[model samples]
Target chain A: MKTLRVPEATVTRLSIYSRFLERLDRNGITTVSSGEIAEGVGVSPAQVRKDLAYFGEFGTRGVGYNVKDLLKYTLKILGLDQEWALAIVGAGNLGFALCTYRGFNVRGFHIVGVFDNDPTRIGKRIGDLVVQPLTLFPEIAQKENIRIGVIAVPTSAAQEVADMMVKNGVEAVLNFAPVAINVPDEIEMRNVDLSVKLEILTFNLGFRNAQSL
Target chain B: MKTLRVPEATVTRLSIYSRFLERLDRNGITTVSSGEIAEGVGVSPAQVRKDLAYFGEFGTRGVGYNVKDLLKYTLKILGLDQEWALAIVGAGNLGFALCTYRGFNVRGFHIVGVFDNDPTRIGKRIGDLVVQPLTLFPEIAQKENIRIGVIAVPTSAAQEVADMMVKNGVEAVLNFAPVAINVPDEIEMRNVDLSVKLEILTFNLGFRNAQSL
Candidate 1:
């Protein structure tokens, strides 16, 4: 595997391309050109080729790409070829929604545990999983070999939850709490601020309005 | 307002910086340097300066910036200075979570309506707002002056919801549905794929492991 550092934007686009390929593969589409992939995901044809080129050449000069082959390659490139065990802390509305979200399961992410410190939320069932206490996090994480921890708690508790996750043994964290939480340097962390996207929309609308004026 | 084309990533970083400034302001911190802002949001000092430079200079040479002033500037730049009326379509788990999300309310985003096509979900109450049917979207949107619409529906229903939002006079859309939805060129659209961030973490972990091998 070539370990040249790839741009984060390219990684994001690769995830989109992988999803588009999945849709095509489901529809039984066998072949796809860079233009087709670009059109399917709303990117330029050259961009599609450029992002794919970072990994390796996957298509012929004019033959384009084989849908299944390209899908497999993108999935492998995205580290989705194998299942990842996940533990979601804070069994609140966001956590509940993530627990039931079908997107994660379709992409080889399995929720092994859902946990909360609240007595009211504890023991509640979210699909096949039960909302365990934070006390059970270590045990469950060890048993399930959970690699990823999701912080779904409120702003006040996000940092504490991240600390506990790090101590327990999770390798990476995907934080949903709007606040920034600190983790060890070796642990990979990402924040998914739900409001950021809405703000982007507002910014564009405001910018356009300004331009017209 | 200068109409220079600002990169989307800069806008995103600005949002982070704005949030950090808000935190500082709440703590009664009056002044901040680019280094402090960058440290709070985990970006390089130079990168923070560059992003803010796109909008205009905010900080002094060595005196740093007024916390409240920078906060206001970022909010204004991101169009969060004025309250934006939003209509969220779907009202499922994701929609329910979004309707109750406090982050939106803090940043001047007000949810005026929540709509769902499912009869069972239509009359449900999430927080102070009641979920209405999709039929009432146009009426409520017009009455409430909703400028933004959020699509939290399923993949199959996402495009339909986008079309309804576009037809009902929403200027911008924040789609939470994993699938891509098309809108007219005049309308601004952004997709928030929840799984994409997790894939980034997985990709990094996989790459590190591969490199070690």
Candidate 2:
């Protein structure tokens, strides 16, 4: 095995490319060039090639690449080839949204549990799973072999929930608290800043307005 | 005014830098070096300087940057100087979450309208505003002078909703539908892939496991 330090940006692009390839595959397109992939995903062709180069060569010099094979490779690299059991904490509106979000299911992530500390929310049903109290996290985590935990709680409770998740043997965390949370060095963690993309749109709109002046 | 073609990545970094600076401003921090900002935001020092250089020189050679002034500059560059009125389509759980999301309000984005086609959802209250019917979108958009629209509908309705938003005179859109949506060239549009970051974490976790084998 080789020790590879791939840039996080490359991983993000791989995810995007996988989705683009899925579209092409569904559309019955058999082959695609780097240029086509780049155009489909709104990225530069050179950037497409550069990001892919971090992993291994996928496309030919001029004959392009098979869409299905590329898609499979991307998904495999992203660890979507295996079924992942996930637990979403903080069963508020955001947590409920996460539970029903189709994107995770499509990517082979199964939400095994949804937990909350509030007594009223504990017995509530979100999808097929009943919300359990936070105290049951360790028991449910062990019973279900949950590896990934999502923190959808408020800013104040995010770090505490993350700490609890780590203590219960979760390997990775996806935090949606809008605030940064600290985790152990060994844990894989990422913050999903939902508002950042909105800010980007506003920035561009503002830029266009500034240009018109 | 300059017709500058700033990269989308630069806009994203600007948003992150702005948020980090906001935290610093709230903490009463006066000055920050590029290295400090980079450390705080998890970016490289040179990358921080380069991002700021795109707007203009903000820091002295060695004196670093004034936190408040840089915060204001980044916000202005990102169009946060003026309040942005937003309309969220699809008053489901996701839309309801967006309506009350503090992240948007903190960044000067006001959710002036929430719309849905469902009868049950139409008469419901998200916060201070009641959910309106889809037919009322045009009227409310015009009355509230909505400049940005959020499509929180499912993937099946994302494109159609985006088209409607474009027709309703929206200048920008933030899509949470998990599908790629097409908008007119004149409208600023961005897709929020909430599951991509989770996949990235899974990828890294898989990579680390593979390395240790």
Candidate 3:
């Protein structure tokens, strides 16, 4: 089991692997080799083994991996073994969507609170949580023991919101703002740039078009 | 120039290369060898060459590649050179956020229109475009020449929304819905799951914890 040295790319792929494994389990897959998992998730089996090996040898040399055990191991590696209380920073449409976002509650993560600077949105309810003022983030985060922060604010205000989250001792951040935020090396950030994916797809289409010509 | 079919993994890495090249260019880097680009992007120089070779002979035998030229070629290969019109379905939280989503507009892809089933939301304004009923999708999409469809609707309605987009003649789809979609092989689909990212981070953390013990 390696410590905190897992590459960010590896972490990202592990997330993909987790989803694929869940799909496998649902299909009643009782066991899987790294190669099978790789094919299913679109990765090299060696890469899969290397990623899993960062934690330990979950798969036997000749036999394969027990599906349920591997799932548990992946869950543990992702820090999803226990419930993580989440706080959404922006209470706008994206933030509101995230507050009730079905994704969080699915994998041992929960939105415990919502915060916004706007007074109109404050006291509004999304899901079971009521929106609170941004001024109360420090207090509420501490009270709820929130470890992760979701910043869905505008680009102009993203850095300010990120700084606030860092100062309040939040370690992991999921940023949806268009711009990238510079954080200390210790703070883990996974930026969900809705546009980057499209840009990549755009590039893909462009290449395909060029090849056709 | 040899067009060796590069792996999907390699194509994904091109974006990273493009980003690094931009950084190098910004730093006044005019020329770089394959080794340099590989080192900067944390890949093998041979890999860099191989990936670039897929599109065309981007590098000279002696000199590496012109930073700007290589970037432009990669961008073209990725299809970022052309503008894409986007039609979004479901004017809910995700839809509204995407309409105001700064990422898409900055990248040459524009959200020309947003459609929803809710009559109250129809005819309302979001950004520069007016919200229209989902019924108008075929008409508007045809009129606007929308080639890309973005389905930001909830999981329950995602399939129906996708079917409508397909019927409207959108060839590529970016689904933000939680469910897996079934589409014809000719149509390209990419799903963005925010929770999967968190799950990967959790998996890494879990693996580290196990190794330490």
Candidate 4:
């Protein structure tokens, strides 16, 4: 049978849904209805059903979703079933922090190598990984099976680093740089611009303040 | 007349619109058609017009919006017409990174005080301001007129810190902690979770991999 395609929004929310389910699992919830999961994750029950329909039928009409079975399905659907090796570029403050981040390591993702253009930081150790120079990205990726490249470099050098990572056969990249980057259609890119986030909050507060006047 | 209410989604996009407008302003573009601004911000012209209508009609039906007028109105609507003082809790790696962050200062939001429970970090100078203990939040907020709080504490301490900030009279909060937080209905809370972003990327890769199999 041909695999059913899921919307990117649905897949995005699947990660969100999985997080809520993990909380439920910890609270000893062995079963959950669509309404219950929807409320937990702040989505509509109909939307949840529609999103999960593409994967398979995991729910009964009245009994709702089985917690462990649904979690296994979510894990498989999100590729969390297999561990992903991460190559973090730029061993600066942000890069070093990400390498030592317990959150990424806890989520079936491991930072196996830290890459940088800085000579001083290249030989340093962050946790168990010895930092390597940017020149070794392709070599290290080929040998160690590193598929994701994280660009935490400064804005000016971010594009160049992204280009090199794509050239090295990285399929996906998570960019923390403040600038937008251009990557191939086949290469998936996600940008986390801290500045953009602050601007959003500023606007929110601004709107509320204006309303009070 | 009753004040017009803008949708939350439109408020979010207004920040993006303002950023693009700033680029135009820098380039000496004094006026812009709605289509021009929409194209620059990667939104449809109709959507832009619709969003702007939520506040008040600003654009000419044919000629478009006057760039300066639109920019000023958006800024006023977002409450960036004047400066806002902000307090950041937890002067750790993330907090330190945020304090030195050039974006907040540029956007009319000021990080006037940094707070932490650690004695070693408190009283340390980060830029022009000295770090203070969590106990100083109320006094600092009152003295400095800080209206917003940025919470970067660990998950274990997030709720306690947030509760303190709220009691100290912080009406708006931007939480960087990965866990979900409970706030009073009157307080506006926004959570920025980096792990959720990576998980979204994982799901994208998963669907693509599954399709190829």
Candidate 5:
């Protein structure tokens, strides 16, 4: 491994920058300065430059960066240039919502399989796919070459579901169960806690009110 | 304002620390050190202390912090000590998921109203509350005294829903619409883009692979 030791926060910024660049590209923008990107994304120009530095030199010394070229580079760095098969392990409302979530589809993430343990939901259609039993996760995962798994089940079942995803050869996992799950060190995992986001807003509001006093 | 501005990152960490403290309280743990809190929450001990420093001292020199006391303090700091009334606009699958999400209820958030513009979804039951037409937002928002509004509507309707919420005097907004929204500076707003979280994971995975080469 390279000894540079990139920070996790940088990766997150790169992701944000990538999305911003995509929007720029879509708007017929050809080139963008660091300041422009910063203003567009609510970050500082220095931050934009610093985050881009970790990957490689993308912008010219004086001239700005090409919108399309920078967008492509960022996506490649984020591993979104290639198609990724995803297996969602719940057919609940959250899972059903996720199956149709436009964000994933636009980023080349394909939910090839939706698995659940509920018998009543087994044949339920969510979008274009029927829910499959959890037992079929292994077979479908192998057949579809699924790498990333999303856990949208209850808290009690999150760990078990994560374990199954690991056992079935999924590399990265996006868990939405609002609980921290243990996965192998080699396996990448991220938790998407919807509540935490709201709490952040509340904290800011509270902090602002406290400061005013 | 207090003039001592706290970083949004600190607010996020405080939220995580609050949740970790809740789990400790549930386990009957009465005391926890900053190191232990940091370990449980996957943050550095110094970070835990720094984040807490933004508010006030909560830990003793050697005895650490009282679990219940710290939990209470963090929850209060996050503005979660008192019940908050919420209004969620939209009754789609995503909206349904947010309405029933246990994370909000556990943290003292109550969805008093669910609104939708679609006539078909207007009377649909998400939990105990039935979805009302968006035209009723002003009346219900006034009646319920909602302080926080959640915009889970489609992209096209998100801005309008946010405007309606603002017009009804909602103080803070948590948007899940995957689009950047403009609100007045006095109003607090945060976006919970699920896709951005996944993109962060993909970036890390890609960066690690590149380093290994």
Candidate 6:
């Protein structure tokens, strides 16, 4: 059997839609049209429909979708139905921020461990989890059944940390380091370049400036 | 004069290419083929060429691209050629991390002010700038000529912060808040959903599991 490939943009939109639906569910919004979802998330109605069509038939003609049902479907489709155990390397500000982030917990992501090599940072407490030494990652990861590893370290340490994660049985990695780091082909890896979004804004601003000139 | 609209993805790729080229130039590499760049950034060779084609012709047919020249061109096109004055609202962990994030300064984005409504956070220093009260935003933004505002607040405060920024003459916004935010049509706005990337990984992991089953 062959697996149908979904566009990453579609997957991203699904995540957004899931969050929006969750909000609607909380507000007792029982039904929603594609247009409402689009308006809420700032995408086109057709885009919302097209993205949904990739999975299966949803909603009734003109009657719209059941908010609770859609929310459950999107969550299940995105694999948010189950809690994921995660380990974070680099207990710097970014790591500390990620640990305390409310969004992750709302979406069922649990950070099981935070690790660092800096002697000063190690053993320090970040929220409820105490920062552990990098040497303890393998032990903590295995004990906690951690499948995801987050790289919040500096550029110099990113690659080494990724290697450690891979060696210690981390199935996926979310890298926050500015520089690119190589991981095995089979490992699910994504680079979150925080500055890239800022550059987009700057580009649009520059384009507008160029037009006026 | 009509301005050519470039795809956001192309602009994003250009940013990555520019960073990759910068790394190569720092190592004293002069010229590079599209394939080498594609490999470096994990994109296809054709994609590298297609994205660059939007700006204008670059590089010779057989000689490939001049690394330094391409880097300069990309930086100029992405509006990184000039320094951008920015103000960050919230002064929380995310804001502190952004204030100290090395990537922004490397790309010419300078955080001129950090603001929060909490009296306790105000006057606290992250780096060189001290956190100020929300009431001081307009004055600081005006005096500093801040064009971009960063929203690092909670969901409840995200929209309010956005309104404050727009009212204070912020031309663009980079929202780190999880929820969707509304900005004026002319204001260049983008949301950084950190959890979205994590969801993408989970979705892939789930899909792989389904494929094997």
Q: Which residue window of length 10 is worst by lDDT in model 4 chain B?
A: B1-10
> What is the descending DockQ order?
1, 2, 6, 5, 4, 3
Poorest lDDT segment (10 consecutive residues) of candidate 3 chain B: B1-10
Q: Number of clashes in every candidate structure? A: 0, 0, 16, 2, 1, 0
lDDT of 3 by residue, B1-213 (tens): 124455556667786688678788899999999999887766798888877777766777798799999988776666667778899998888788888876667545778889988888899888897888888899989998898999988889999988888888897899999877777876777888867766654554455457768
Off by over 4 Å in 6: none
Q: How good is the docking of model 2, by CAPRI class?
A: medium
3 or 4, which is superior by lDDT?
Answer: 4
lDDT of 4 at A19: 82
Cα deviation at A90, candidate 1, in Å, is 1.6
**Each prediction's whole-model lDDT (CA):** 0.91, 0.89, 0.80, 0.81, 0.87, 0.91
lDDT (Cα, 0-100) at B158 in candidate 3: 93
Query: Candidate 1 - CAPRI tier?
Result: high
What TM-score would chain B receive for each of the candidates shown?
Answer: 0.97, 0.94, 0.85, 0.89, 0.96, 0.96
Point out where model 3 deviates above 4 Å: A3-10, A23-65, B5-75, B203-213
DockQ in order: 0.81, 0.73, 0.45, 0.49, 0.69, 0.72
lDDT of 1 at A116: 95
Candidate 5 structure lDDT: 0.87
Badly placed stretches (over 4 Å) of model 1 are: none
Per-prediction TM-score, chain A only?
0.98, 0.93, 0.88, 0.87, 0.95, 0.96
**Runs off by more than 4 Å, candidate 2:** A1-4, B1-4
TM-score of 1: 0.97
Clashing pairs in 5: A211-B2
| lDDT per residue as tens, model 1, A1-213 | 788999999999999999999999999999999999999999899999999999987888889899999999989988999999999998888998898888766688999999999999999998898999999999999999999999999989999999999998999999999877899999999999998888888898899999999
lDDT ranking from best candidate downward: 6, 1, 2, 5, 4, 3
Best by DockQ: 1
Say what the RMSD of model 2 is.
1.8
Docking quality category of candidate 6 according to DockQ thresholds? medium
Error of 6 at A128 (Å): 2.3
